[model samples]
Target: MSGTGGRTLLTVRGLAKRFGGLVAVDDVDFDLDDGEILGIIGPNGAGKTTTFNLIAGALRADAGSIRLRDAEIAGLPAHKVAARGILRTFQHNRPFKGMNVLENLLVGAHRRVRARPWAAALGLPSARREDAALAAAARETLAFVGLGDHAASDVSKLSFGQGRLLECARALMGEPAIILFDEPAAGLTSVEAERLGGVIRGIAARGIAVLLIEHDMRFLLPLAHRVVVLDRGAKIADGTPAAISREPAVIEAYLGRHAGAAA
Candidate 1:
């Protein structure tokens, strides 16, 4: 499933959100295809996070539409959005402090292990089987993100880079169709950032669409199939990564403004 060749899996059009008189997102539109890695970049206060919130249902849109596989989901709650196979990782990784890495991932897989209340309460065979399957999946995901050795370690004890990997593992436990990554490389050393980039590519190779909001241009430009640039609250450019780099409006509004760093 090539990024541009695949069928459209998500469509956002005229998406707008406002806080008082300040428009955070204004009439933005974009499409994400199956197996695509779409990057969203903009200067500070460009409404990148607000766009994510609207799509994830953490914030309701004041205007516009969001469709997931033809189903309207713009106004749904966060949990409802997750039920539709969309998951996200925050810029700040927030693993359960009291839980081990494996246990934290188990919480992510809870949605898939559908044991009846009675079955769980009675500690029936079905519940036991479900628990085992979830544990296996969690372990597999931990290994995939290169955190297998830390599966039994306390989450609070993990380094910042390890915590980010752990967050990705938890997201994978859900087996989501699309994962939204908000600055996955923030605060990482160069080596750690390189490792995170590989993990992201591995995820896309598995045919999951990725929508990344990141400020690291070096990391994002080479990885994304397409790049969308936002200035203020509106989309200024959307095209192939190469095309986005050469776009004059993008250069003038964003890239040129942050010439030496992320745009």
Candidate 2:
């Protein structure tokens, strides 16, 4: 959907993906405007994750158009898609186990670092300057995601919730225009999930669009500006959270299986 100024930042039209004879996604269409949190929900085996893969360039679309601001990016490689300012966090955290929190974030800033291998090998002043700047930005992002104190800690030492925060911190280091979160609340306790909700709102306040795939309606409903429902590889409904709650098709597709969690 369009945002405050009627600007569409990301658009997916007639997006279709197939695996063998199975239609994983069928003619799905959606628009994510600047600074909006659009939640995607569905039952097991639904095309939620596949749709994310298509949009993030982890998978190619069999038929459709995926656009970022007017540039087509349907089949670009993941790195190229990331360079275009679309970054995604996984359903499970993927921190570099041997890397410290700060180091992991620096990896995410690779595209922004201007120093080439030769410059760094020779210890050029420009290389040193850029490295220092990237480090500073990483630290700032860690603080933004409530991981400031963990900058020096080993990734292996973080709890599940802290790891989730670290993943978000790394995404922030990339300075993406939009972030795709895949089941961000999956393994957290209620309190931790509540905290993540706050972090997501903080991210949106910075004018970044967020498209999240979450099964926790309790967490997703309040955090999302809008919700989209999918079932059997097709969209069933799209509306404000309240409207989605009462949508009969959504209820039949999702609530029958997830009503208790959403209760």
The 10-residue segment of model 1 with minimum total lDDT is 254-263
| After superposition, candidate 2 runs with Cα above 4 Å error | 3-6, 260-263
Model 1 agreement with the true structure over 131-223: per-residue lDDT tens digits: 998899888998999998998999999999999998889888888989999889989998999889899999988888899998878889989
Candidate 1 clashing pairs? none
Across 73-98, the per-residue lDDT of candidate 2 in tens digits comes to 99899989999899998878888879
- Using all chains and alpha carbons, the TM-scores for the candidates as numbered come to 0.95, 0.95
Tell me the TM-score of model 2.
0.95
For candidate 1, the C-alpha RMSD (Å) to the true structure equals 1.8
For model 1 the TM-score comes to 0.95
Taken over the whole model, the C-alpha lDDT of each candidate is 0.90, 0.89
